[model samples]
Target chain A: MDKRMSIDEVVERIPNGATVAIGGSSISRKPMALVRALARSDRRDLTVIVDVGGPDVDLLLGTGRVAEVIYAFVGFEVLGLAPHFRRARQSQAIRFQEWTEYTVMAGLDAKIKRIPFMPTHATLGTDVLRVNPSFREINDPFGEETLVAVPALKPDVALIHVNYADIQGNGVILGDGHVDVLCAKAAKETFMSCERILSSEELQRFGRDVQILRVYSRGVVEIPWGAHPTGCAPDYRTDLRHLQDYLKAASSEEGWRQYESEFVDVDHPQYLTNHGGPEELVSRLKV
Target chain B: MPLMSEFSVDEVIITTMARQLKGEVLVSSVTAFGSLAAHLAKRLYAPDLAVLSTPESGMDVTPMPTLTLGQFLTDVQQGIPLTMEDIFDAIFTDHFRIWINPSQIDQYGNTNITCIGDWSRPKVALVGARGIPEDTSHLSETFYYILNHSPRSVVQHVDFRSGAGNGESRQHLGPHGAPTTLVTDLGVFDFRGPQGQMTIKSLHPGVSLEEVQERTGFPIGGGEGDILSTPPPTADDIRLIREADPLEVRKLELMSGPMAAEKFVNIYERERQTLHATYPRVGKLGRG
Candidate 1:
């Protein structure tokens, strides 16, 4: 069955205060267009789950749409710390639960397998256990070792951006598939935005690169440059100059307001125009 | 009239870090300096070393002059592109060794990349704990490289324990072990003292023991007689570092504020120029 839908329609289906998993690791392959759409919508008080985040988390925090965040790390690698996230945390603006990278994966794994919890040696003695007390310690059934029980992290929805997809909801990631597939499997519903939409036959040629199966996706939107600011590898790189401008604007409240008005509040087409148009973006950001 | 040192502090630290690795499977995180040290080791002594660049799976990646934000994508093309799960599994079960750059590291080798001050309401919020907790708990060996060595960074106790150390509470936690050595701008150190206290292994040339003691927050181990001068980088080692990182990206670790910013801009411009020269067609396409 054809599962294609518009980005706005996908956003409209999401309820307020839902647990949404944002796919991608730091600075790579994030579903930013979907995130921007969610921010532009009237949705509020979201609990975002991300393994590694960059500007996507910060933008939601800056827009005051997020009430809590579950993440392992949220800083921009190399560029510096994320300003809005830092400010929000420092001021007690939002509640956050920190987990190690492994625990986050383990939690998702448990949910995917339909298990109550997963066992791992991670987060045993670290202060992560102290902060996130929900994680329990259980003795090994067969041995003397103790393991941390990572509970299932079942998201209400998962949003991901991919390099290629079909109307049937099958997707292909040309670069490192950084837990995007896991997030899709772990969430109840998954939506994907693709840089290009191909026929099912054409997508089949990718073989193992086609990690996102059709069964995992509820909807797919063909949105070119969907991972802008972040990157969709083999197609374009991160718009570093734009990210620098974002950092500059995010430094102060007034700057952030101006940025939101110029970029965040606009439609995807307007945002594309404001971000130097398709021609400029392709020329500069293309790998 | 000023005296000049034979080697910069970064070069010596890189060399010292390289000396510790023995051609094993090494994992390196985001720090350019630590990555460069791992690359240098692979090229010089540990030719058999397998370097896995994390958060993205780029195994046995070749060296680059400067690392862009999308470096993993570029490196993954040259080598294998494993998923995040594969990388985490390797670190957990394979007993790979790793080097981390933490915001705060205590004497017992406990490190914190999380928030500072209180965990509930932090005085300063840092990047949340990424992989250090699992890396330290499961890896065969964990090492640290610090660009800035001061009382604030080399603290008495980390505000948050993002990585397990040799603290009393961690005895039965089944951690692989505390970090073996920590290389910094001032010197090299090991947790060999009684109760896993940080002991000075060697001081960089021209640095006095008093300077290290003053910079450290706690009373450091290793007596004056026991401490040795850190061996300076050989000519070959310096050449290898320069060749691997021609734009001197490793130097940014030692600098801060406006100086580092200015240097970074210079390096970025040089990197662009080099890229254009090497790939003229792609460069013109990018510009046009």
Candidate 2:
């Protein structure tokens, strides 16, 4: 099995119209490098499944790389409004399948369980579940009585970012699991980007069950401090200041190109060294 | 500034609001402004409740509402049908309500929706009053929280009354038949008088009585009741917030830590440093 490959190779694996699952919560444990790679790959008509609901999604939408999105919410980190998601939706540039937080989790759970669908009581009355008939809906036996049902989400691939993993593909969520673990389990294929590849013995010594790793992960890449400007683990905080820059830059074509050239086009490790260089990089880098 | 002992006063006020909300299905966008109050109600009063967001999924910290500019427009164009009153009805048959954030709230708890200058030619643009119309006029009760207790925010006659709970608009909209509570970082105020002019109710922790007086946009009316403090999270409240949802702890930690402690985490500052340090820019051409 190929444990690592150039970003172009990873992009090649994503079919033109594939539905992909992305893991992370806001910036924590996000595959920012991989996302930038995919964006630069010029992949179009793709559907992205995510849990971040923030600028990660906004960047993709703004670049016109995503044809549709299935998400719960898209606000700024702490303030109100994710302006990019809003403007894109307003223009109808992309289609959407909306869900409440619970139902989205339930849908992923259904996929992991290999079930056809999941039953949920969320959005039973409001117009949200009604908006996306593909995944969001009401099971009406009769009358106004309704039961909300979210369709199972079986993505073509799940792209995840984690703190550490072993040669055998056993991954550990360093601090918080976020949604990456769930997305990995729910997809048909799982690709993880990690900081360090531990020896198999060291991973087993930790003792927490690497259930998703052995069971679901198809490939893993060792990209030290992969989620930079975002959190890694046991080290620094998200470069929220940098993230804000991404949001502003990604809003325009010129800005995005500048972002792409500087960050995305590099070996994963080089990307890190280049962005912050070695020492300041060494200080904050988790791996 | 009220001492720590005064904490119970805020709790009582919050509990008073909670008591009235029992049995109602509640709904609200996730915002720090109303999140604590909403979280309190969700944990204590509305457990079986569900949260909805405009972003379909894959959006925010949790899959909760991630506010975007367009969605803000949607929320404004078509007010989230899940009205505060509707949420109240779910909490209880009679009515349910929430204490929301207002940009510029006034003595009558009348919130400003339009621009500060003339409605047509406003100097500074504020988020137009999105749901205040329904929240103040239709809900059985309305509550307002002003985080920054400043003179500009708590004014005499708001340039434009976005949601009406005060004298003139109250007469125009008639009554939705509910009392209003106005809480500020400085102090607590409540609607009194026939026209719903806000009367000083309580002061918050670390706020001076004189400060509250000086910051008012307009003169406050009624008895200067003993000002009070807000309740710290109860053990049970903390437990549910931390465990019932793991994200709460993580989210709070992130929000409270060093990255967040910046006086201002501006891209400009970051850009200057990133450039000065001579590091490679990841996405585009800029510094931060």
Worst 10-residue stretch by lDDT in candidate 2 chain A?
A121-130
TM-score of 1: 0.94
Tens-digit lDDT track of model 1 for B157-240: 999988888866366565475678999889999988778778999888888888999999999989557678887888888898
* TM per prediction: 0.94, 0.57
Docking band of candidate 1: medium
lDDT of 2 by residue, B218-255 (tens): 76775456555544435565444444323221233124
lDDT for residue A194 in candidate 2, whole number 0-100 = 80
Indicate the residue-level lDDT of A90 in model 2: 54
> Considering every candidate listed, which one attains the maximal lDDT?
1
Q: What is the lDDT, from 0 to 100, of the residue B225 in candidate 1?
A: 72
DockQ of each candidate relative to the true complex: 0.54, 0.03
Per-residue alpha-carbon lDDT of model 1 for A53-135, expressed as tens digits? 88899989988889999999998776778888999999988899998788888889999999999988777667888898568
Q: What is the TM-score of chain B alone in each candidate?
A: 0.88, 0.62
